[model samples]
Target: MDISKLKEMPYDELRVLYKQHLHSLNISKATINTASVDTFYLWRKDSKTLFWDTVLSNDFESEARSRLLKTLSEHSSGNVNALVSGYLSHLRKFRLYISSDSTWEQSETNQVKTEKNTNLRRTKKDIVIPSPTVEQVEFYLTKWDGLENYHLQEDALNKLFLELCPNNTDILDILLKASTLNDFYSTNIFSIYPVAKHIRSLNIDTRLDAGDVTLVRDIQHVTISNKKRSFYSFATKYCSHHNPLDYPIYDSYVDEVLRYFRNRDNFSDFQNDELKDYVRFKDILIDFRGFYGLGTYNLKQIDQYVWQLGKDYFPKNYGKKKRGDK
Candidate 1:
């Protein structure tokens, strides 16, 4: 049947034509009842009938009703009841399908919108920490060049340790290197006597191979002159300097930087236990680095980038020199 001609035909003529098509398909009220609802719809869809296609495609109840009412008003002089009884009887079941589909779509859409709003609200309440751009990282690395060679101090400490105790060069090297690299400023330098005595007392190798928790516990046990807070800084700096790809620095500046990145990237908060566990922390760092496509940069270079950014943006938090502070 020519659908364009049917659109132009009078309501009675169109209804007659529609009935003829249904008769050709041998689809009667008895046949429709025998077929399942889904099967009937599928058969109608395959029939290539314009009216069925148009009605079925209007998945929303209101839209389907509006379309039917508009068509009826235009072609049938607003004779809705007569049109439904004669030609539009099939649309009764179609209307129910439209209503169910519309309700399900609306419910799903509302649920998605609610979740998005909740996440947005939570994000707004969070403090956004800034991440370093590639340009910023390059600039920071240039700045790092001015700092004195850490190897020189490490060599001196190693030589001094060898003189003090020849047998325990390995353990002494770990302790002295870690203590020297600590960025925390102090008037009283770390004394070798107490550190050496403490190293002699420990059974395990004082290096990071002993695990971060054990190393930290041992450092805290031996730390004198109120240097407890710097224990992590010392140990992390030591491990990261030796194995930049494997270990990341975990100082206050780095902590602030990581928190900022977490908020910015929408990552979950790090638990205290996870952060304290060196292997777990390393895994998180590896994941984060991979996520940002920062695999090419070593942890030390990444550390410099974050440290400089923290100082620039969070001066008070990192104790960076303020505009007026000497």
Candidate 2:
């Protein structure tokens, strides 16, 4: 297949082209598995140049290459020379196209330009909060109440903190679980223990104010390395449980739900950077509540609504079952 022609073709057309090529090569259906086809489809969707590059590389670890080799070997009926010659012929043509054409470079340049334009638009966009209906608010409130009660007992550290003061051990335990649970990236949980201890020492009255900038600042001060996300997750849950009406949890789910609602309602886009700043995030939540006349609902209730909403509408973002319950 011509690399330029493949690049010009739509994803659906590209898949058909690939399938037809496989058939022409006399590759058996048994060897050309769905996984191989799906992988190729994904690659084609991502970048035709990349897909061709990998296919031509003949890397054993590359799924496309492995599947192609398997198919060729099977068709050759144990004739090693025929299999080698057939594989080389296909590989040589693909290699020649990639080496000769500037398709890959051009594609990369276009991708860069597209990303630049997207960032430019994003910078100018203002986030808009959606207005919730009375019925929606009531449903969220009920779910929030139920979730709060359930998770309070489910999370060991949360339950302990509710009964006892914010001690180092309890605080560290919360940090540990928050860092490890459903975390794709591994965090050094023990490294952040000092940070948790400092937070406990500050005795930052969790009951003071929900949107306390000082509280976030204090927490940030103790953040040694890349533990900000883990620390904040633990802090927000602790604070929210202490004063549900004041503090709301901030996590990936909440962020996803907020964006989902905004997009669903065609509201303005909020920056992920803004959410990183705890103060800005809290202000956004407060403004969001006020905008929708959701003052009657507590912050924890709002958190519950966002979480449940994400789980229902954006299951891919939630990952594991019953994860955000706590």
Model 1 over residues 208-273: C-alpha lDDT tens digits?
Answer: 443444454454345667654234444454344444444566655555556666655534467645
Per-model CA lDDT versus the true structure: 0.46, 0.51
- Against the correct fold, how does model 1 do in TM-score? 0.43
> Top model by lDDT, which number?
2
The sequence of per-residue lDDT tens digits that candidate 2 reaches over residues 1-326 is: 45655667766675564454334333334223322244443253356665555655556235554544554344322323222332333443434434554323447676566456544542202221222534456776676567764555446545544554443346665454444432322222456556656666666664244446547555544545644444555456545555566677777667776665444443335776777677777877776666555677777667767676555544452336454432
In candidate 1, which residue ranges exceed 4 Å CA deviation?
Answer: 1-135, 146-193, 203-230, 241-245, 317-326
